[model samples]
Target: MQLTRFTDIGLRIVMRLAVAGEQPSDTTPMTTKDLARELAVPYTHVAKVVGRLAEMGAVHSRRGRAGGLAITDLGREAQIGWLARTLEGPGEVVDCEGSQPCPLRSACRLRGALARAQRAFFDSLDEHTVADLVRDPTGAVLLSLSPPPPAPPTDDAPGNRHLPQHR
Candidate 1:
């Protein structure tokens, strides 16, 4: 019943960028590393989530050292409810589907009720945009965010997860 971390990160990415879109702090577009540091998430995670947001048309990105991210018009106007729903996907709330099978698969009014509730949740979220979430007129939200503790160095770099530890 809880939102997935992916959805959470997706929201954070869009909201952070939308807030930053106002020229808070560094006005230039933020790279994944910058976002990861600002949001207190892993760089790999931010990179992956950024790709998802880009695919969803919530943000745009560039490559190379100059590569960075920026929220799009869609991102700024994104509805939290829609973002949650879209990121949550069309899967069943309680896994009442086949193959694995659920005891309630045959007749589950709970599923219908859950669906209705989910719709209502999104309906409420649709009333607000990403901008609505940022109420700080002084842009304190951007300024107040603190960096996370440093990540322990990992030898498991991309495409090298199978590599033997050199240490």
Candidate 2:
């Protein structure tokens, strides 16, 4: 699975705000600077992302000292839903080329099995809400401090393709 850094960061920001809850504490508002510091991301990068998020109405921002960032209801739901789709990739997996179908199409049990696994992957992700990520802010913070998850196995992995034996 290929998750764009944008969606990953977007979800992190949303999760943080959800953990922080609805009130931004006296309207002093949490600035991107504060968020960048907490998230260990560069200030300018977070600012740019925050701009896009604000435009999408996933985050609300104000200008000036008291102005800061907070999550809107729409932003939370939309961001989560968007992540569910894009996190997997911008494309579909089961594609057939030309008029030729895979010879295994008729007898391959693994085809449907893999499809079920793929569906489970998405369904599992969709079950989560931003609220779930915030259930334990400290734990979430600890987890994010670690590196990103390992990349999924590629076609280069062993046994990825069936091969014929040499004569």
Candidate 3:
């Protein structure tokens, strides 16, 4: 079963935040705009996803100068399948009950088969957590997209060279 665009964006947001959280010195929260830019998605789309994630308690958002987005512990430890299901909602894989319903809705074995397939897909995802999505190479790549923390001032700098040593 294919994930909706919303779910896809949601997953990406969580993954990015999870990667950032893993870094001890990367405490700076990411802004929605930053996430949108990094993910190459629309600001509105990212904002909507962020809102949903916040509502679900998977993400935390603060407003103001120090305000930005951060993944909660719940988000970091969230099962992939659970997150997917929450983002995907309770909709069926196929539109078996639409305005113009399928003629074979009553006797379609295909629908049942598709449902099972979808369940299996989610069950597979349940075996992993969001943290599992950003291991090594993937984590490194994601980290590269974030701006590095400011470097500490060195004693060798001209301004600091004349200062008395505290040690």
Candidate 4:
């Protein structure tokens, strides 16, 4: 199923934040312009989606040079299917619109079948989270944003298990 622009951008926003979280030292939250550029979308579009996400408590936003967005803990842990449901609205997939009410409206099997298909689609997506999306090793989006692997442990390092007793 094709997602609406709003839902698509919302998903992108979450994934972007997920990628940001993957950064070991990249503490600066992304500005709307930066996110827009990264996603190849208009700045205004990102702002609008950011507003919606902020209102939902999925993101935290502030205004100013130091202000930007960071995904909320709730957002980081959000399930893909749940986010889609919120963005898409919990509405019936097929409307019974016609020039006049169709005679089969009441006993329509198509509606039931369509509903089942929708459920199955979402069920599959439920198996994934925003975390899983960015964890796709084959994709460079998150990889490009990630920091270098941390150095290996050393005996003299803080919290090193092999440190000699000095007491």
Candidate 5:
């Protein structure tokens, strides 16, 4: 269930930008060389993935004296969604509702367990915007990239009543 290098590198590039936020005028637009230097990835590899992300509207690239890359809102959102899906094992899980039944269907608990866990994972992610991811890229640096935590229930009353349940 490992993420493809393409997705992995693209996510790294986005994280770098997210962490960088608004680029400093002194900091020239990041070239593939700059990304390579900072992230330790080869320029060629990063370029392809980065280009793909741009094609997908996940990034915006400019050409000229200050030509470089920056994150777009769409790119940021796509990156966050991409990371969430990858961490949850992406294509490795089957939705079991109508697919071919596995031989272990009668005994395998992993499927149901993972399905419940995946739903919860996505539910938690739905609470976050890409801005959150940009702010906390380091939160995942040396640790596992788990799903975002479920947001604490909001207090809506003087007695500290929880917010209304979401459907």
Candidate 6:
């Protein structure tokens, strides 16, 4: 079963956060803008997914200068299947109840088979966690995408003009 774009983005976000969480120095929370830029996804889309992740207790968000987004421990340890299911919601792979309802809705073996296939897909995912998705090379790549922390002001910097000079 193909994963929806929404679930795909959500998974990417979680994986990136999990990678960051593994690196103490990289634990600085990332803003939605940063995540969007890094993932090459639209800001609005990332924002929406971030909101849902926060609701799931998989992501933590804080507002203000020092506030940003971070993956919670729950997010890092969450089973991939459970997270995917949460992101995917309760929609069938094949829409039997659309405006033009399927004529075979009442007697469709296909629907049952598709449902079983979907379950198998998720069950396979259950074997992994966000951390599992970012081991070694993958984790390194995701960590490389993180924005560097702001540089501290030096004595000669414009913002440090108020500081007393030490010869």
TM per candidate comes to 0.80, 0.56, 0.82, 0.75, 0.54, 0.82
Per-residue lDDT of 83 in model 4: 84
Tens-digit per-residue lDDT, 1-167, candidate 6: 88889999999999988876566776567889989988888899999999999999999999999999888999999999999999999988899999999999999999999999999999999999998888888989998884555578788898777877689
Backbone clash pairs for candidate 5 read 58-75
Residue-by-residue lDDT tens digits, candidate 2, 3-74: 557667777777776555344443456678877777877788788778877877778999986688888887
> What overall lDDT, based on C-alpha atoms, would model 4 receive against the true structure?
0.79
Tens digits of per-residue lDDT for model 3, 56-166: 999999999999998999998999999999999997889988999999999999999998999999999999998888788988888878544557989887788878778
**Model 1 TM:** 0.80
- Cα lDDT over the full model 1: 0.81
Model 1 lDDT per residue over 18-135, tens place: 8775554565678888888888888898888888889889999998877788888998898889888888788766767757878876787888998888788788889988878876
RMSD vs true structure, all candidates: 6.2, 14.9, 11.7, 15.6, 17.6, 9.4
Kindly report which residue stretches of model 5 are placed more than 4 angstroms away from their true locations once superposed.
1-6, 19-27, 62-66, 77-79, 86-90, 94-109, 136-167
Residues 9-113, candidate 4: write the lDDT tens digits.
Answer: 999888887667455767777888878877777789899989988988888999998888898888878888888878888766777665776678889998888
Query: In model 1, how many backbone clashes occur?
Result: 0
Question: In terms of TM-score, how similar is model 6 to the real structure?
Answer: 0.82
Candidate 5: TM-score? 0.54
